[model samples]
Target: DAGVTQSPTHLIKTRGQQVTLRCSPKSGHDTVSWYQQALGQGPQFIFQYYEEEERQRGNFPDRFSGHQFPNYSSELNVNALLLGDSALYLCASSLALELRGYTFGSGTRLTVV
Candidate 1:
């Protein structure tokens, strides 16, 4: 019954550093998607995972990656972080790829100094 949950609700990093953010999908959800939301902007899809494989990806570079476990939990990793990468990383879960059924987490706010 719990909603999607993301760890390290807030983080501060420096350029060139790498960061890994985690998320646990809601009960009965099998798909996990990651999004990046900059200040005053809408969420930008990063990628989506289902059945432990990446099913779809956004316009982000290869440095942005993700994984979905058997338990439906997921992780988002950004390598060689840039100051422009600072934003709210959101995790959304759903029974499938249906956007209407997605449930989002509060998101992990990343600040690159």
Candidate 2:
């Protein structure tokens, strides 16, 4: 089965706008995690979703939101985009939140103008 998959490999948005990023988990994964990677920096966790609920979150602002479906796919929604929000957003999937089995996608590169 395929690993995690993300949509719109790249996109550009204007400030104050909102964007929604999509993710599809691996065949057997039941959890999805999202992260943001700025230039020259490692990915910073945004949040994780399991059983359609937010299981955990990082230090990101409330402007960052997400939802997991019954089929294990997920979406990350960012509102009121700012220049600082321009970054690579990653999607990782794991079985039951196991870190060791995380399979990540290439990520969606979002550039806020």
Candidate 3:
């Protein structure tokens, strides 16, 4: 089965632009988490979603936003992008309260010029 799926594996945008990254969770999973991974660094939690609501968030600014659909798919939206926003955006899926582990997608590589 498809663990998770993210579109536009690679993307290029200019500063001040906005981008939306999409993710489809694995079958039977009701929770989704978004992460940002920079070069030479570990992934940083961005947010988590369950029941189409944002249940938790990290230290990111308001420019980072997300939405989870009833189908358990999700989207990460970044507005007024900055160069620092360039990174590997990861999408992970899991069952709420299960907590065993999460299935991650290949990720989308966003580059801000």
* RMSD in Å for model 1: 1.1
Model 2 over residues 1-113: C-alpha lDDT tens digits?
77889998999999999999999998988999999999999999999999999989999999999999999999999999999999999999999847668899999999999
Tens-place lDDT digits, model 3, residues 28-86: 88999999999999999999999999999999999999999989999999999999999
Per-model CA lDDT versus the true structure: 0.94, 0.95, 0.95
Q: List ranges where model 2 is wrong by over 4 Å.
A: none
Measured by TM-score, the strongest candidate is 3
- lDDT assessment of candidate 3: 0.95
Comparing 1 and 3 by lDDT, which wins? 3
Ranking by lDDT: 3, 2, 1
* TM-score for candidate 3, residues paired by index: 0.98
Show model 1 residue runs off by greater than 4 Å: 97-99
TM-score to native of every candidate shown: 0.96, 0.97, 0.98
- What candidate 3 gets wrong by more than 4 Å, as runs, is none
